[model samples]
Target: MQRPKPAVIDRATALRYMGAAGWQPDAAATALLDKAEALVLDAATPRAALRLLPRSALPTEGQGNDLRRHLEGCSHLLLMAATLGGELDKLLRRLELSDIALATAADAMASVLLEQVCDALEAEQRTYFLQQRGLYLTGRYAPGYGDCPLALNDELCLAIDTVRGCGLAVTEQHLLSPRKSTTAILGAADHPVTGYRAGCATCHLQKKCAYRKRGITCADS
Candidate 1:
């Protein structure tokens, strides 16, 4: 839904991406990010969709107790998918042969750019859900985020008509094709919800997460 012309790649986010590789990027990482961001914007085709479902339909098995508790208050689910298409993958492949370091930096910049696209998509959907359905949205929760089962990746295909609707597919390994795409479920409620923590802190993977290592929370990331 949002290809955000030239992704507003910030220094902090680039550093966080480098931190994922167990390193850090300089303030000038944007110099490199500019190149990748340009390639992504030029090649990427952004698209998204919103599907509403009853809370009972979400998967429960293949998850830990904390995740069960995390979903307790929700009455409905919102299935959303967004993709930057597959063009960037081709450029990334070429970049891989040209320079590994540049490829790594590009990968990091692409990840942050994908997040920005998702953020913009979510913001638009959040406003629409609140205005039209009178529902407050819990932040977007993706499969493999926290203890949610990676198995749900396939299920989303059915629930959201993923391939036909959004040009996304999940491999047997559970990775989304196009690499830059994302699928998430957000909590929908009739009124303001409480007693729920949000962002990366609420994630089961937060302890070992590189983003958290640098003091970044999920919502901010």
Candidate 2:
């Protein structure tokens, strides 16, 4: 059975996410990250009866066009879900002042948290892929990035039962919960992996990258 290794988050990334919410990574935040990591790891380990239907499986011309135009050459789809415990719900309620406010906050936080979680998961998955001489990740390609359609969230939610299992449901507008959760697609290839440059050029928000603006350099030099 395929098991997802533990989710890892660096202190810096945790700080960044907390900062976005106007909250500093106090003792409470540190404690939360530690607990969240454990919870995510435990949840990720269980295998769900899930299938990743390819772009070909989509029925509509618009969807086909969306996949062909955006997700061309994409080969694999990984679907994962976990039941959201009361703790997550409590966190969401505490952070969100109102429905609209919560939605807005969730949109931003979800992307950050998801990116960190996916990075950790992909690192482990890449190791496995390399051991098998199969494929390794180039980088994660998420919806609403590089022309990938955001509309695919519905498909992802259905594929993984994001609502029933994860307590994460997509609104009519397609946002996730815990105000800091995420789902994404990653590109994999059989080629030997190259280290991700910690430079502006390699960044997804290269042109207007906040990390760059904050003088965060991922460059080896």
Candidate 3:
């Protein structure tokens, strides 16, 4: 297990999460965002865990047609889960009650922070697998993306003991409990991974995405 330091956050990414990526933040908005960033970071307790399992570990059915396609040609699977922990969730709730505006900004900032944590974990594991096992990883594909059922999150969390390991839990609606937590599956193979969609094409949110409407992408965000 490892945790990424929440020392920085990408403003553009946070803006994207706030659905204001296309507009420039005025001083007030900027200051609010900065405050949100500080609050989110101060409340964050990042933690992550990774487990590499044989491809056979996945059930043959109900894993989603697209997910199976995504894992094609891969011999192994990597289960990853990460969280900013319960303190941030509590902070967001407090802000929600006292200042909804700051709560909104803090929520977006927290999303970016969680994304960074996942990215850091993936990068570290990618390097390790490449150097030690001569493997390459496909981009992460999470539950509820495309045809993948969100229910898969429960199995994934169980597989990695997420609750015990990092205080992460799955809700009745299949959402991560902390609300800032995430779990993903990555395919590992001997050859370089290809056909990974880092764009909006396969995104479940593409239909209602602000970035797509503006003819841009949150890929880099």
Best by lDDT: 3
- Tens digits of per-residue lDDT, candidate 1, 1-221, equal 33454435654676566764434546576467667667656777777767889887766545654445555677888888887788878878889999787688777767776777788877877899899989888876677775566778888767888888878888998889888888887777887653244445446687787666667665565
- Name the regions of candidate 1 deviating beyond 4 angstroms: 1-7, 20-30, 194-208, 211-221
Q: Can you give the lDDT of residue 217 in candidate 3?
A: 72
TM-score: which candidate is best?
A: 3
- In model 2, the runs with Cα more than 4 Å from the true position are 1-9, 18-55, 58-74, 79-86, 95-116, 130-133, 189-221
Give candidate 3 misplaced runs (Cα > 4 Å).
198-208, 211-221
Per-candidate TM-scores read 0.81, 0.52, 0.90
CA lDDT for candidate 1: 0.72
Give one digit per residue, the lDDT tens place, for model 3 in 41-85. 999999887788988886625676778788888999998999998
Global CA lDDT computed for model 2 = 0.47
Candidate 1 all-Cα RMSD: 3.8
lDDT of each: 0.72, 0.47, 0.85
* Candidate 1 vs 3: which has more lDDT: 3
Compare candidates 2 and 3 on TM-score and give the better one.
3
